[model samples]
Target: MLGVTSVDLADRRELLDRLEQYYDAVPRSGARVEDFGPLSLFIREGQGWPFYVRPTLGWSGSVSAADVNRVRVRQRELDIPESFEWVAETAPALRAAVEQAGLAVHEHPLMVLGPDVPAPAVPEPADGVVVRTVGPDDLVLPSALAVPHLAFAEPGTGGGAAGLAELGEVVRGRAGDGSVKRAVARILAGLTCVAAAVEDNTAVLGGCAEDASTSGRRIAGARPVAW
Candidate 1:
């Protein structure tokens, strides 16, 4: 049993690494990469604000007053195009910076899953629901996979469409690159549930779950889905 668990974890890790690589490769429009020696940053132009990602840290960036003002100025300089969002890990330095800058701080917990754990019990489909695995050739699959958790999310705090698209790109890229082997999709009553499994034959490294319900439906009694 212990050996089986180890193999599961390994598989999860491999999938996660591949997903990270995919995100690193696909650049977003107006997205900029900043290298801070110990960290790398991905910044994108958003609808109302700029979106940011720190794949290395596994956390989203909070806005500082400085960041807030800087972004505002940039928007004007860039002709105030569209809404934007930013992301980063909640490190001490980052937290302090955002706080000192007078930007409100929002917290999002990072979750992970491993192979020793049992597979998520298949969810019951709602009326008129259909579930299917998204194939690699389906370009729309990536966009669909990228939808964020909106029902359990706070207002102005969820990763909207662009964020979801980014996520989908990562999942597809990793799976295609031999970093992941198994990915699943569940759609019930016109809503969707997606899970990405990354593991070797033995252990699971990590997994992520997304509830894609148009009516903001959620999976009740569902365990933490791996990512």
Candidate 2:
């Protein structure tokens, strides 16, 4: 039977693979990933505690105690905290391994919106509220910034401010069509607004990459990788 998330075990593996590849392509400032047989270790320097180890397909089976120890060893080597993503439906074994390693488990919603899905219209806000996108050139402006970090904070913690900016910089640098800046500018211009068509750029909204893996090249959502 399928799990609470609706994705069956077999399909979940495929989806996980795409998500992994998608994350691999993203440009993180000081984060490095190391493959260790059953899982991949992501060690990020600075911006608070680091170290996150995860298996691409946790449903494959229970990980050996030795494998879990490897993750701890790497965390100690980097002097960082221990954390990783455990899918509700497919990570039973990974979850067991981590729990055995004496780490707490937390859950967060992993949402996905496909291209074929129609986007809802932007809502109207109360009086005195304004909204719009942050223009490409205005990315450096202090007033125009500050939304990203809080929006994309770590799951349990407050926020990843440095990581947000670094990711923004990477998106900006890689932006060839000026869509990234335009999207930001639009969001900033009005407190309630939606960028209808953003092409070839990175978009941050609702605290995550809204355009991930889209043909429009917006934020690159799961569709590109999942299908």
Each model's lDDT comes to 0.39, 0.50
Off by over 4 Å in 2: 1-14, 27-30, 45-51, 56-62, 126-130, 139-227
Q: For residues 65-105, what per-residue lDDT tens digits would candidate 1 score against the true structure?
A: 46545544554565643232223322445546556655566
Q: What is the C-alpha RMSD of each candidate to the true structure, in Å?
A: 14.6, 10.1
Model 1: residues with Cα > 4 Å off, grouped in runs? 1-50, 53-72, 79-90, 135-227
Q: Which model scores highest in TM-score? A: 2
In model 2, what lDDT does residue 3 have?
43
TM-score of 2: 0.54
lDDT minimum window of 10 residues, candidate 1? 198-207
Error of 1 at 77 (Å): 3.5
Error in Å for residue 31 of model 1: 4.1
Judged by lDDT against the true structure, how good is candidate 2? 0.50
Estimate the overall C-alpha local distance difference test score of candidate 1: 0.39
